[model samples]
Target: MTTHTPYGDDPSQYAELTLPDGAPRGVAVLVHGGFWKPEHDIEHAQPLVPSLVEAGWATWAIEYRRGTGAADTLADVRAAIAACPVEHPVRVAIGHSAGGHLAAWAATQQVGLTHVVSQAGVLDLRAAHDAGLGGGAVARFLGHPPGEADAGVDPIRQVPLAVPLWCVHGRADDVVPLAQSQAYVAAATAAGGAAELIEVAGDHFDVIDPASEAWARVLGLIEQLGRPAG
Candidate 1:
């Protein structure tokens, strides 16, 4: 079973921590997706907790504030990360959709992570802005257009983060599109970052579904990424 704790005073600023049967090899910080909205809560990520715990990872799934503003949303994420218990040897973040963007952004911000997994993430804010993703989520997130936004906020723009990134995207996803991950990985690799793009067969949510092959691939990737404590 998973236990919950508050990282911040806000109800949304809580996290769920679950330990494995034996000593955990690492910690997997799970971030959920909702196009940066408050309506979508952390319940979506709860289903995958069992699989991660079964794989010997102490899962720390965070619930962050959103739709308030970019700074507050990111601030909540960073704070939640800071509050995470560092009892394991390795620590990695696995985020889905908008959470993936936050995970990548967190990596760039030097959150002391070993690696990052962006599962069908919205990595390119400029492109997403141009394409009008999530009904102008980038604009809502930045409170302005891409041209007026800062480069620090965009994951694809911030290539070569100190930590490596594994971008897993569903090829059949119409929500975020496979090109999002592909473009980000291409740019990161070109900039000398160990960013890899892994395409799986399914839609956006398939990457999070415990029974799906994409989810299995994601677990395998996380396992490979769990190197000796960095």
Candidate 2:
């Protein structure tokens, strides 16, 4: 995998690796989940990059500042998307865990991101905070308690655009729980947006285990979303 930091000024900050293909369907940005904390780095997503490259889709795995400034992660995402070849036909944003929340936010801020996929993502920040998942490092990223941010930045409160939304969750997930994705699907549907919620056998980590069936399901969703531009 070739490494190039889109924002070279940031140093070896966020590295991107694009699959080598003559005519690719499009590109997918895989946002790794770490609850927007410093402990979980982008290296955690390295294993899944090859699988995406094999599928004829280019993938960009991003790294950003976590914690209270984590809200700025969207800026890094926009930079990554802008760094890609403008001719790519389709573009999809995919993320796991906390990254899912960021992906959803990115979709709202930018145009041309035709699809979004959240894998066992923490979609409802308010719910997460209430469930005690938003404390500590998470609280720092959110910059507020669950009760306060619930009305503003919560994915559940956002109005999704016409872009196709896919939410995948493990039936056995205990970290973020399946309810996170369930809540998001409900909100997207209520907003008159197209959203699909898929359930698979596994837990939070198992779903993204790469070798697990759930990972395959995620890849399938990406292929469907990253259709040839035309």
In model 1, how large is the Cα lDDT of residue 172?
97
- The TM-score between candidate 2 and the true structure equals 0.90
- lDDT of prediction 1: 0.88
lDDT of 1 at 66: 86
lDDT of 1 by residue, 109-197 (tens): 65667789999999999898888889998889888887734788888888888888999999999999899999999999999999999
What is the C-alpha lDDT profile of model 2 across 134-164, one tens digit per residue?
Answer: 3554567756566753454567778665687
Checking candidate 1 for backbone clashes, the offending pairs are: none
Give stretches of model 2 more than 4 Å off: 134-137, 147-152
**Poorest lDDT segment (10 consecutive residues) of candidate 2:** 4-13
